[model samples]
Target: MSGLAEILHDNGFKVQGSDASENANVQRLKKKGIEIFYGHGKAYVDHAFRVVVSSAIPDDNPELVAAKELGLRIMHRSEILAEILKQHHGIAIAGTHGKTTTTSLAFTVLDYAQKGAGVINGGVLYSLGTNIKASSKPGGFMVAEADESDGSFTNIHPKIAVVTNMDAEHMEHYKNLDNLRQAYENFVMNTPADTGVVVCGIDHHEVAALAGRVSDRKVVTYGLLPEAHISADNIMQKGAAMGFDVLIEGKRYAGFRINMPGRHNVLNALAAIAVGIECGVDLETIKKGLMSFKGVGRRFIRIGDAYGAMVIDDYAHHPVEIESTIKGTKGGFANNKVVAVIQPHRFTRLNDLMDEFAACAMDADEVIVTPVYSAGEKPIPNVNREELAKRMRANRIQNVHVVKDPEEFNSLVQTLVTNGDIILCMGAGNINTWGQFIVQQSKLKS
Candidate 1:
């Protein structure tokens, strides 16, 4: 929503918003000259032409209620994004994971290739230091990270659609995996038939199936599979960096390197490369753009050093994301012990995928489970950190501990970390604070 405010303000719209509290994004919008209130109320909506609300905003929000009483037009964030797509060549990145990084990479590639692309991402782009970048050139492309959690991604009609991968996410909304797959199928099918191109990661069955159903549009498959139109070969990890050769149509297009760690990121880069090539970007420029990408904030971002150990923070809440992040960290730091500090994001997710989460943490040498971050949801019965730790131990995970308090978790992390170790704090909630706290504590100790 902050990105939307920035975009609107940049386009000469008077925007004012109110959040429950001030955060980094609110401060950013304030710097951009957008009026942002500290709390929600009806007064903030009195002078507004329209009201925009995110998925998290409740129906009873004071501003929302007042807007309806005033008969003001209310719009979902996706509606505004869809309208933005109509003005520019749109490339919407949709998937259960890796969408932000992939969208950021694609935006960077287009921007560097002089395509004049704008971006609206979920996380801050490390290179740009902001989530939204207005297109500098007229009639250029807009790269957007499409959220599939609410099935509203179908509202977008993009020139090119990239699905990094699909998984059983937001089951609370979809009810089952098949329902979620149908949503993705609809998102892909909603693309422009004559000009749309679907770039998908064939490694994921759901995404591969969605690609197969796109008969009227161009479909580009990418991954480690031999049948992929764009595939990576000879992947090598050097510490926190990875190098790989991009193969297009079974031939080497370019050898590229990225500062991010993981094969999933290589797939993400492949998606960006495919999009760039589809949009007439040169192979050399695409390689350069990807190589220059520092990575999105909180996606395995190295926060600081804790007793010579690297403290990394990531937004990995789903089991698949957690497993991929841990494996990627292990691959990058092969010799270093990977200590995972995890805080489950929601009670419903923890209750639904307890076993998968347990298995996801098995790769880490030591696992520290924290209390679940409710994210506004009511707590579930018998779903807590101790039970999760017990499940991990049942899965043959040797060292598992629970730290219910955030302050105590920081102290535990200080004692558990050592030189050459990598403390990977993973979750969607405030677990990144653990990484930051450990770094600050390390600085104090030093």
Candidate 2:
């Protein structure tokens, strides 16, 4: 939400916000003339401006309670963002995965294609050099990553909606995967009739159902397979990058290259292509847009090289995400041993999908599990990393260990990582801290 604050501040809206931690984002916001509070404070709430809170924050937040007690207007972050988009045509990228990259891609394409556009993303986009950007065009576009973690996508009504793919996730919030799918369907259906909805054909059935429901919106499908409206064909791998020809309507239109790791990224590129093509951008413009993307900070981003080892930090917290990320790494470095330092994301996710997590990490040559990042959730019995490591060992997976801190993780990597070894620090938590520590130490020793 730092991006939102920055954007508002730039637009002459007095912006003040609070965070639980004073991380890089907080620091950046402070530099951008935003008054940032490090902790919750009732004093932060005042009668001068509106208060915005994300879905992750509870209704019981002291600031929110104070705002309510003062009878001040309050808005969910998503709701306020939707209001901000009113002055510009909006494209909301929604999905369980790939939203960050795709949304970043869309904004980059618009900017590079010389069409003025604004952007908001969940992750720090290297292209914009910030999480948000302001544009100055009468036909300006607002491109945003529509998050569905707390069903926030429902609050956004974009002129264009891109559903990368819907996977069964955020089970704690949604009753089931079906409920999650239905929520996406409602999001699509709620769009204006003249708008377009681009659905990734990988999740053809789930997203196609949305197309069936939204008769007013134009629906287009894209994927790696030929069955979609836009398909990626003749895929070739070179290191951590993939080069493929994007086919539109069974005809190959143009060649595309994505330096980002993973087959899932091929799908993300296709989504960007679809959006660009619909917006009347040239094929070369789209290709350049994709090529210029250095990738968002944590989506398979290489932190730095540590000794002879290559360390990558990724925000893959789900089982499927873990498998995809590992597979992508293997595709890039075929002969290198994969050492994974995995910090299970949440207690509830660990308890719910323990077996799947084990299966995903089993692909690594060596796996080290760290204490779960609770994210404020209470721990469940027998659902810790030790139990996960034991299960992986019992499953005949070799070289699995449980670690408590970054020091232990660095020590494990020092022992296991050989020349040309690929070390992946995987999680949605502070696992990147360990990766960064290892890389920094390696740099210092060298």
Candidate 3:
């Protein structure tokens, strides 16, 4: 929503918003001179010409209610984003995970090649230091993250669409795994038929199956599997850099390097590579873009050093994302034990996917479970940290412990951690605040 605000403000629209509370993302917009209110009420949006909000906003929300009463031009976030996309040769990246990184990477490739690509990402882009960047030429080209949580991503019909992988996510809105998969299928199927192509990761069985469902649009596949049209080999981690050789239908292009970790990230890079190729960028320039790429914020980002251990943070709320993040952080070269600090985001999600969540953190030598970070959702019965820890214990995960609050979490990090341990904090909630708190506690604030 902030990305939309940024882009709209850049496009000469006066954008002001009201949030229930302030956070890093809101702070970024404030730095850009965008006005944001701390609390919400009808008076906030009373004078506004149009009020924009995501699907998560309740109907009873004060501003939304007032907007309807006033009969102002109210719009959904996806609608505004879709309207922005229609203004350019847009590329919409859709998936349960990796949307932010892939969107950032695709923009990097185009920006490096001087294609003047704009970006609307879920996370802060390290290269631009912001989530939204206007295209160098108006309506020239752009890339955006297509959200699927409320089945609203179908509102966008871009020239190019990329699906990193499809997983069971946002089940509260989706209700079931099949419905979620259908949404992803609709995302690609909704793209412009005459000129659209969906870049997909074929390694995921469901996403691969989704490709078959889209007959009118061209589907480009990339992954570790040989069957994929675009695949990579000789993947190695060099300190923090990952090097791999790209293969296009048995044709090899050697020495593709990205300054990020994990095979999952490699797949992300491949998706961006496919985007670059479709944009008419040469392989060498695409390689240069990948080499110069920094990374997205909060995806394995280092927040602090506590008790001689490096603390990494990521927005990995789902089981699949957590597994990928841990496996990526391991990176096959570190001797240090990986300790995953898992915070269940919502009670409903924890209640829904207890089995998958329990077994996802095993790659870590130790696991610290935190209290559920309810994003204003009501709690579910029997869906607490101790129960989750019990499930993890059933999986025989080593050293699983549950921490009730930030104080205990900080105590454990500073006192018990080994000299060379890697503490990876993963969640979609206030876990980032915990990372920041640890940094402040350790005087590691940079």
The TM-scores, one per candidate, come to 0.98, 0.96, 0.96
Worst 10 residues of 3 by lDDT: 437-446
Residue 174 alpha-carbon offset, candidate 3, angstroms: 2.1
Candidate 3, position 146, lDDT: 91
Look at candidate 1 and tell me the lDDT of residue 374: 96
Residue 328 error, candidate 3, Å: 1.5
lDDT of 2 by residue, 342-388 (tens): 89999999988898887887678888899999998999999999999
**Model 3 misses residue 150 by how many Å?**
0.7
Global lDDT of model 3 = 0.88
Q: After aligning candidate 3 to the native by TM-score, how far in Å is the CA of 233 from where it should be?
A: 0.8
lDDT of each: 0.88, 0.82, 0.88
For model 3, residues 182-286, the per-residue Cα lDDT tens digits are 788788887888678999898989889988788878889999999999999999986557899999999999999998778888999999999999999999999
Candidate 2 accuracy as lDDT: 0.82
Residue 52, model 1: Cα distance from true site in angstroms: 0.7
Candidate with better lDDT, 1 vs 3:
1
Best-fitting candidate, measured by TM-score?
1
Candidate 1 on 371-425: residue-level lDDT in tens? 9999999999889998999989999997898997767877787777778898888
Measured with C-alpha atoms, the lDDT of residue 190 in candidate 1 is 78
TM-score-based ranking, best first? 1, 3, 2
